[model samples]
Target: GGGWCSSDETCTYRLTNGLGSSKYYNETVFFGEIKSTNKTVNPDFYNWNRIVVEYCDSSSFMGKANHPKIISRGAQIFYAVMEELLEKGMASAKN
Candidate 1:
């Protein structure tokens, strides 16, 4: 499982990590331009899989979503890194 998150030659304004707009842990990131990110992409993005994102309002976590990921080239790279982590964890579990 591998994914990648990168901007195409056209992107020259901002940066971000994942897909599907702005999903965050505390608050939904709907505003501001994404400058940079450390969140890696999970292979689940390239293929079929499930993803859960914490959605909240101005107060707290309101709910969650179980859906597939739709990301850009940059976000895809991040997804790939996430895939590597998952694989490593799985392998370690067997050992």
Candidate 2:
């Protein structure tokens, strides 16, 4: 996961990893544990569909950034994701 950055200097450093930008992201990721489909390992959620939000903003999905070179929009990403999920049936999800 991408760790948080508290200052411009640190956030600038984040550019070198997936935590800071998609340029460094992997094309695919492995999902395990609660995200697993193996009934033996995740009995209750074995059949559930899941989505993985990569930790990129480094703000714990709480804040935005004003740096000219850094694009930080954690809050916006969170709301947009929620909106899309709701529209796609999450609004009526039972679990």
Q: Which candidate gets the maximum TM-score versus the true structure?
A: 2
Please, what are the lDDT tens digits per residue for candidate 2 over residues 1-95? 65689888999888887878789888998778888899998999999989878784888888776678877788999999999999999999995
Best by lDDT: 2
Work out the TM-score per prediction. 0.21, 0.88
Off by over 4 Å in 2: none
Q: Per-residue CA lDDT of candidate 1, range 5-92, in tens?
A: 2334212122232222343133433322232232234332333333333221111222132213322333444455568868867445
Off by over 4 Å in 1: 1-10, 13-72, 90-95
Candidate 2 lDDT (Cα, 0 to 1) = 0.84
Error of 2 at 50 (Å): 0.8
Clashing pairs in 2: none
